[model samples]
Target: MGGKTVASLRNRADLLKFDYTHLYGKGHRRPVIAAVTDERLRELVLQSRSWNHLAQGLGYAASNTKDTGWRPRVEARINALGLSTEHFQGRGFNGLAPLAHEPVFTADPTPERLRVAATGKAIAWFSERGYTVSLPVEPAVYDLIVDSPNGLDRIQVKSSAAADRGVHCSRTLYDTTRPGSASTGRYTRRPYEPGEIDYFFIVMADGGMYLLPYEVIGRSMKITVGARYEQFRV
Candidate 1:
């Protein structure tokens, strides 16, 4: 005689298959299906409620990947979160998932490239003006320190994908937006302040750079860089 059917076995055990593509894209490992531990299961249970939010938390696209190889695991989570799994394949959700999705963030696709190019240009600009540059071993409040004939100046290097506007200078806003939950994080403009940074060094998407003093800017978020601010361009 044969053993119990698949549905019966699943009902008797915590045997759900998760693709784990959300963690690592595909082909890195074989047999994505595996039994999750109770602890891991608990953490997953506490994750964002809405499917869109869950996808955001997973760092994956929600509109797609619904009928993926291991959607059963997602179904398990959806069920646990009290969401109906019907029509999960479609954009139209017959059920709304939980609500703990992380803040959706937009990042430059090639920030490292911009950083390297901009840093090189900044070094050249400073060297031409008779300044010695020192890079930090461990990144801190500032990425570099400059020793000029005038004096020492501490600099914070910021890179942005935006070429049309200045880069974002942000600070986390607390005790304002969401009242109860701290999971919701909000980023706002935090202008350069005296004693915090002597200069704001910015690198734009097109490899353009600016080395502006703190006095030039006010106590507002965004440090404008372009033709007007290009006087300080490196």
Candidate 2:
């Protein structure tokens, strides 16, 4: 994305600037399907704007990368609480929303659904592990909040999935919306004004619920079967 922007379907003439797009086919006038074949070229094409662009074209704010010294502790919590991807499914968020559970929605039947299911599962799963789950919190209908047993330790919930690889992944984002701020962080809203939460989590379902760090999945994060997990402290 740095210097590789491409024109839309109608403005493909710009592609002729590169010899890479015309490896197999004789001329650049042919469609890419007939022109490109080499793996490297294919990778370039794959990494091309349209190929890696998120299924959902939403823009995202960069996550705070400063380590918060919480990884070892969080990992320990995950281990002690048995928060594996497999265990945090179906029932993880059940305690918070009880009767009103939202199933992962997707246009196609793919692993994205599993990621959605796993996210909901992580909420309920954490709650069952003694964490408190809160949902439909005021100001944001799509928001879910999780409170760790340590009392004040809280995590805001947000889920994402990409069917490209048949997997679903969800991550917790820090809410940076405080009163009177020009804008909020990835998960904060203007209504909260200067309101912000310190820590964030990213959970995905490759095989089960793996809690990832917010930074790893920040920009254009997509859910896929083989998507790797990234973790950030604080």
* Per-model lDDT: 0.59, 0.39
Model 1 whole-model lDDT (C-alpha atoms) = 0.59
Task: Report model 2's TM-score to 2 decimal places.
Answer: 0.29
Query: After superposition on all CA atoms, what RMSD does each candidate show versus the true structure?
Result: 20.1, 28.7
Residues 89-145, candidate 2, lDDT per residue (tens digit)? 242232121335566564664554654564466576667787776765466423456
lDDT of 1 by residue, 26-61 (tens): 342123223444445445546544444444444444
Q: How does model 1 score by TM-score? A: 0.41
The most accurate candidate by lDDT is 1
Q: TM-score, each model?
A: 0.41, 0.29
Tell me how far the alpha carbon of residue 212 in candidate 1 is from the true structure, in angstroms, after superposition. Answer: 0.7
Model 2 off-target regions past 4 Å? 1-112, 115-119, 149-205, 213-234
What is residue 184's positional error in candidate 1, in angstroms?
Answer: 5.9
